[model samples]
Target: MIRRILISCGIAFVTLVANAAPDDSIKVVKGQVSDYYITVTHERIVKGRVLDKNHQPLEGATVMFFASPMHSTTARDGSFAIKGADNDIHLYVYYPGKKIVNKILALDENNLDIVMEDEAHKATAVRRPAQATRWYDPQAPLSRTFCNPVNISYNFEPFNNNVRPNGSFRSSADPMAVEYKGEYFLFSTNQGGFHYSKNLVDWEFVPASFQRKPTDDDQCAPAAYVSGDTLFYTGSTYEGLAVWYSTHPKTGRFKRAIEKNVLPSWDPCLFLDDDGRLYLYYGSSNEYPLKAVELDRNDFYPVSKIHDVMMLRPEEHGWERFGMNNDDEVTLRPFTEGAYMTKHNGKYYFQYGAPGTEFKVYADGVYVSDSPLGPFTYQKHNPMSYKPGGYVQGSGHGGTFCDVKGNYWHVSTCMLSLKYKFERRIGLYPVAFDGDGVMYSSSAFGDYPNWAEPMDIKKPADRFTGWMLLSYQKPVEVSSIDSIYTAANLTDESMRTYWAARSGNPGEWAQVDLGAVKTVRAIQLNFYDHKATQHNRAMDIYHQYRVYASEDGKSWTLVVDKSDSDKDCPHDYIELSEPLRTRYLKYENVHMPTGHVAMSGFRVFGNGDGDAPQTVKGLTVKRDKKDRRSAFISWQPDTDAYGYNIYYGIAPDKMYNAITVLGQTEYDFRGLDADTEYYFTIEALNENGRSPLCKTLKY
Candidate 1:
């Protein structure tokens, strides 16, 4: 009699027929089986040595076989060995600061030697498959300080519309950051992927598309929430959306938790209460108020009826009016969106962005309540995060997240709407809640260098590195300039304008005179996309340039060199390893990703030899009786000052809101709570430092 038996091991199964045999041994399998197949197969030990182009053994190199989990790291002698089935296999070799090597080799071919080329020799070496370049070198030491416009590569707009016939400029906005398992993940609109960081300073991009459904947009104003060990994510959609969940986001592996949401939401935010209840807040419109609803944690479906949260009150909230500077209420209505929630000390804070993102006055406002979905009361100090006057403006439509050290940070959208209304960037600021329970985000010196890990959490200003701008309004000379784009635009402190070279060619340069020798600490090179035609995210595009410093106009010393860099940094900020004293700085272009070489700002930051600007003598504050939210403040301008900072709050001791005004003595203070009494102060700033704040005045 013949009998059939099936044996399963792990993922492979084998079917066998038991025919009477003298030995009674298993016969050959009919289906594919695992390595534990009854038949004996020979395994060979594959050995290899990895070396650089110079024939020097590259220690710490990683060697692995493609399509196999087996990997080994080279020892001090750059030799690695792995035992595998005797067959031809694809091998991959990787080393820091070197290009990856991939080759097909026979497992029996032992003592194999592989040569890798340095990134600097990429142009001359044979082209291989493109690999994703990390934002920072993994072998280099982690950075302690970082500058804003946050530094990661922004993605080009993916679609072509009437606004952009070709492709749109690079843009990212409506940011949301969350801390999961000691690492932070950042998500922004239209950036085909997200970025994760162990130290917020060194970020690695993870390519992922959460839009499993048929939709034109990807993750627009995505909502991210961490619960237990898993992180749930979804994007703004008018139709049913999928909620993706990932335990290991670093690997970019996410599975859909909810295939289709029961309700549709735009600009959504997910909040999980301490008691384990989940809620969602969403809205992005000028005609409607933000809405909220309780959700079932298991199924991620709404359990309670939608509740009307809050709407734009432009008549009483000056900052809510729609305009470039909150001054266009007559023609345009304000937009209320970007809903976020943070529960602290038993009170729930509902934060939302107001006005318009296309304007410099884009800011975030907050309301306090005792319940997740309730009648929330407006916070007296409105626009909790505002940076209307800075190198990069707009501090709205973002999420607040806490780091591992319990420090709170607000990552918001910074406007760069010159190319399209959606063109934008992201900025991070220190957030704190005082003893009185008033929450605020510090934007003073917002665009300057700030500490990634602050020294003190109580003092929000401690985040600033005390690096003053030394290149603002300084004299500049360029090799060639287009008639429409003047050289003066380089130091004009505006992202909307730029100085373009006659051509995007090598050796084109721009030199800036600091007027006097000053101690230089950091430099920020803001490159502009002047006539760029890229419509999609181009990973291979990069920028290469060199910066030099000079004490005298003639003798120059190399300061920052990136001639062979394969990474793209449109808004590149470099902190020198050591401080240098120089009065003149020059930026020489080696390569441009596309279009003419253009720069919005070549900002230098450090201390000046001279004293700080003097405090203002004449100060005035006039509150509008018709609309209590409006006020007019002016101070006597300091002759030696390049800018001024206006500080105001509900009380003298609670002065947290600051607005950095450049080359202006008067400001139309229009963001205030109608019933709150306020105090105001002003201080002058120059290349050296800031003056002592003027005496606090009550209004």
Candidate 2:
């Protein structure tokens, strides 16, 4: 028998208080495990705090799951606790007009700090999906950082020395970024709202203007399209085709375009052709082939039946084949989803994400159709947006939009499925058309803190962040540890192993010694809740830690002090306004939310020696004899190099594009404008910085 469980989630930033005050209005049995969930091998207590966007505690919030009978509520501190079954559960949180949260709770998981935004606090506006009321200004520098799976808090407080911990954390997928009114707005499934920004780097979350709030599945793979003056929105729903429209997304209101389902749509996209026609593309699972249908011009509803548009062929398209390098046999058919359409210079470009969203290689593959609705042909240069080797992966299921600088950017999803199966992040990458009119995504130096093209000031031809490891394999010291967990785990560069203090109390701490004075740029402190059980029910717990640096172990200078901080940061990072020179960095725990001070990454990013990398050797650039548009480039390995960069352009001085490969010595350049002579240069990069460009080669 299926049972429904009730529980709430929130990240409270309120005055410190216990959730001990019980509300007589509702009855809840705390720590009471039930058999409603199957395979109940173990039952654990779940605890967390809920807060509003303003960092205030949300009182009397309700949290529940659709599958279990257990339920919970927030007390005065906007905190809740309930017994969790062995199975994973999705908890739904509701506050006044705030966008609701559908957070996941695994059997062994607890301690959630959820944040909600209050809708009443903002100036709200109503809009239709087909009208656009705003535009972006091109006079400003675009926000440069565009790494996938980045924490939103990371963008708000950019990578700097004075940056604070992430007060809010979220996982969103199926990105749809739209440009309007001199600004860009980003929408994602389960985000409750959309985010807007003048520069792409710094984003502000605003409630979506939807006539009807989305249900669970409806939020999975939503789609958006732009017409003359309207921005149309819809989502995956077998129940019905619920469409929304908004001219001003920043104001957080959308009117219903269609309330009924004319066609069964999932993982959908609404495409409007240049000839004033419209179409819808969808089909999210591997089990089904992708299909399209034409929409009526008047109501924007499906006019006729759905047409079978395309199907997956793993044998032909290796990138579309399941698993990394297309090797998975267990799941024979790869999941073909995230259908998108972009008309570039009269050619219809059809893009879809494949392999699987959860995998590191999750990416987009493109097909070209002469007509908006037609038989499409696959592009030889498949996997339109891919980044397998980076701190973050999975650049798929995202829409492309033009920025104020007229540069095209694809905002895509990043994968971090550990916390939950669908746990994700988002990123943006630059796109350009080669001389052959071939579309290409620039990810060579992707995810790094690279400059954002001409919109951002022109830096070195290679756009690397110049950030190198300062903490990997470094010596670590902790206050005390349990048997298995050790201080060494902190710098082992593995998320699987973590350092767990014997007790999580004020004054407990850990320190990392670089062994010598090194210029430090950033510190990322990742916290892990491993079977943690040391918090009062329904109350907020925040980061009250102190960070200090010292040239020597004894003499310390305060670098980051959160002793009086009210922010909750499970995955915290800090950047100094200016680089700090120190041999030792200490992370002192003033207070912890769970039973012990558990940490996975006490990472540090900076320069060592403040020097450039060794020059690459034996640089060879040979144009593909068979394919003039393609080039084969290779270089000799530099022992101290963390990665290599390949720069190429049609003109000698205009080497506009680059590719950064880590631990690899060779890269094939496909999708180059056919019949164009190219100039090529290479460089090596380490923690310190990139070396000078190698001798240029003409192909």
Candidate 3:
């Protein structure tokens, strides 16, 4: 007789067949069998091939499992075999400059073939449906609005071999934007080139360097000026460096204007006056005052002796004190550099960056004079450009210029200083002169989304888009995490902290759950360089990723697809073509240039479903008796608010200066004129919106 029995061994089911054996040793206890064999099955290998649109084999393409760590690269014949779980699996195929292909198949399946299309060519060929709500349009004109930390491809440090032997982070500081022949040209320090744009929205990099002299160093804090049809450029150096000029800067063609500069200066500014005269203003030291000298319009040589213009008086101006918050005075002295001169209404406004570039308090102050070289007097409303608090900080070491619409704008350096002390970015703000001729750049929501083109500037907050942040302190989830770099860092509202995945491989992702279904309009992905290896500018380096949205976390719909993007965007901001009403947003990593998949901020902005925070109460302002230039401002904290914006000025209508303090209820306002009686007010802000402005109080 033959008999068969099924027995449970622990959690496994096993079958036993016996031929009428008299002695069968099978011990069973509590439905568990002792004699049993557990057969383990290994993962199966999935094979695939990647081909181009023309059926040509594409090599070096990456094939990765969506939720598994197993991955493979295509061989010369475009064939790949990756091991994965025996069940159904999701796979992603990625090739540079080609459209990404995603597939869902069983691991037992074989001979998977994916045909990729050219991303650039396909983008141009695809057209949006006439009646559809479009989220993005490559061919359509961009909106007039823009945000701070201008979105350009910031290059890695090219010549810092001594301090950065392995590699440094993306940085560009000391910016100068000038309009030349109806186009705007941007020049900054250590970029290895410059960028030009027809409208400031889109910038095209032009690789060109100055003709260096024997005694000069590379460009650090460059200066550019447009005279007639030619745009002149030079760098900061104690030893004279040659000046270059270019009529067609878009072509990256430049010729030496002067073989060697006549005067040796650092942080130089080449200013061309309305009267056909030229002057150079330069200074970059804590001890020395800014100096100016007339340059001959003919040969670009000094025509007059250098004269001292202005110096830093930390004792008098509280904003000039050196430290992270202008609170240090025992050891460090403030350094004043970046001398920029703007002539308006027959009055010369000399602007300079102060304190320190690495500090959040880094700002630009103005001094007024009747002549280019002055016995200058400090402006009553000083620090013409100040941005002490925001997502990106600092507004120092920059130049100001007028746009095509005759609207004044200031382009300045923003602080990053994470990888290295000089690691930074650039920002642009709308500037205006009051009826009294006092010049001030509107920086009140400085880093928030604002109109990129000219708009009504009657009020300081007129340029703000009113899109409140929706990702602050939100819940987040991730595919993988490091020991320390957890997912919580994503919504901390800080650039210094980041969420770093365990690997840089494809399929790693982070998902954020906005507390409720919010009307999402924009997303800003700020990538952090964690364990990056590249030391210099790499033109081919880029990031590829995909974003998805869903009301429920399980069912996701594609929103932003950049899997084939060729451009490098360290701080990538995307404004959706149509608003997405979803509670969850997911970011899937396709490729990283040099490091692990790390992100400092996965910021989401739009309207909330709830009400704005209530107006703050118990507002108080105490002017320092010993130092009238500084004041202590505080208010009762709101339970629903995440931060406060303190607005103050000499008059209630003129509350032009605003300090954004996040996660705080108090601020030490120090950038004040001693004799000015200021009016102060505070506004509460949260993910929903900003509260109504509190009652103004005179101090």
**CA RMSD per model (angstroms):** 14.8, 15.5, 17.3
TM-score-based ranking, best first? 3, 1, 2
| Backbone atom clashes (below 3 Å) for every candidate | 0, 49, 5
Which ten contiguous residues of candidate 2 have the minimum total lDDT? 129-138
Q: Rate the local accuracy (lDDT) of all candidates.
A: 0.83, 0.67, 0.81
Q: The CA-based lDDT of model 3 is what?
A: 0.81
Residue-by-residue lDDT tens digits, candidate 1, 1-699: 223244444333344445553332334333445222243345667887888888888888988878887788988888889766656378888887788888887545677888999874445435332222222222353377777898877877765562355344788999989999888899998777898877776676787865444324568999999988998998898887889998887777889888877777899999999999999999899999999999998888899999999999888788898888777878867999999999888999999998999988899999999999988999988789999887989999988988888888899999988877888999989898888899898998789988885344556788888889998888999999977898999998998888999899988999999998889888889988777766556677789887888889999877776776787788888777667889999999988998889999888899998898888878899999988878988988799999988998888988888888998889987777677788999889998888999899998
Q: Which residue pairs collide in model 1, if any?
A: none
Q: Which candidate should be chosen as best, given lDDT against the real structure?
A: 1
Where does model 3 exceed 4 Å of error? 1-133, 138-141, 159-167, 211-218, 454-460
- Regions of model 1 farther than 4 Å from truth: 1-142, 162-167, 210-215, 454-456
| Number of backbone clashes in candidate 3 | 5
